[model samples]
Target: MTDARVPDRIAVRGLTAHAHHGVHGFERENGQTFSVDAVLELDTAPAAAGDDLTRTVDYAELAQRLHAVLTGDPVDLLETLCQRLADVCLADPLVEAAEITVHKPEADLGVPFDDVTVTIRRERAP
Candidate 1:
């Protein structure tokens, strides 16, 4: 038989946010800038042919949903944030799989760095 495991992929990058996501009190209270990157796996053949937005994943809508997730809830860890984002991406009917990453610029560790990020991947139930 031919290969049946070919995977489709879509990417949304440079998603930025400001939120209070951390363990420390200051981190929760003061908040900080956060960024996100997401990759979604879905069938694009139909959309490619029809050239219709409705036929495929909408990045704008996805970004808005991600924004809502970030600003709507408060979490204690980046791991939780990443998982939540993955859940959001997987909620779409067209999405078979998703990889999500959340980044924080001003971490509590007092290190000089651009950001700290967490990533997670998930697939829909077959």
Candidate 2:
């Protein structure tokens, strides 16, 4: 259950989007801002050596893909959204592993808090 493996990474952080994802009816109807952070584990040596965009992750496209996940579905759990986003990062063959974090800043927790976040890490099965 513990995946502490570390490797070179390409990261996209602090992406905010309004999404309709929650268990409560009010939360789904009203929607809220969700912050996401994605870390892709990959060897950047080739891209760095060649200075080729093709050899690396196109972050703009990745952002759009992640955004689509946020804006597309109405999942009831942040865990589901996190899993989907992790899969998006791992879509690239170059990515060996991924860590995805989703933060619900505007959650209806019935109390004041900074954030309620969910994080998941996935590695390609070897």
Candidate 3:
């Protein structure tokens, strides 16, 4: 629920991309700017101690992977996008949990807001 309760997260914030994710035909036809923030829960002790890139989860590659999933397809809902991103983050062996948020700044909503975002969190299966 809160960052203080989630100590195992490797926060990856400010990931931006272009996607055609919405319920309208125009939205699907014309992509919009989307921002993503992913917090991957993993034990970085090994990597921290060994000082090796391979010893722990690489945030750079993770960002690219999340970007691919976000822009790879046209989803009708932000919830679906968040779920998929969570799934991808949990796919890694070192990841124990993840929280993914997808924000649409230029959404077609008539409301006067900066953006609309969907956030989801999940843990790996035992």
Ranking by lDDT: 2, 1, 3
Which regions of candidate 2 fall more than 4 Å away from where they truly are? 1-6
Q: Clash number for model 3?
A: 0
Top of the candidates by lDDT = 2
Residue 23 error, candidate 1, Å: 0.6
If both were scored by TM-score, which would come out higher, candidate 1 or candidate 3?
A: 1
Q: In candidate 2, which residue pairs get closer than 3 Å at backbone N, Cα or C atoms, i.e. clash? A: none
lDDT per residue for candidate 3 within 10-108, as digits (tens), equals 888989988888899988998889999998888887888889879777889998999999889888999999999999898899998898988888987
Tens-place lDDT per residue, model 1, 1-126, is 997977778898878888888898888898888888999999988899999989888999999999988887789989999899999998899999998988887786666786788888899999
Candidate 3 regions with alpha-carbon error over 4 angstroms:
1-6
Order the numbered candidates by TM-score, best leading.
Answer: 2, 1, 3
Write one digit per residue (lDDT tens) for candidate 2, span 32-117.
99989999998888999999989989999999999999888799999999999999988899999999999998987888899999
Summing lDDT over every window of 10 consecutive residues in candidate 1, give the lowest-scoring window.
105-114
Pairs in steric clash, model 3 = none
Q: Estimate the TM-score of every prediction.
A: 0.92, 0.93, 0.90
lDDT agreement of model 3 with the native: 0.87
- Evaluate residue 12 in candidate 2 and report its C-alpha lDDT on the 0 to 100 scale: 91
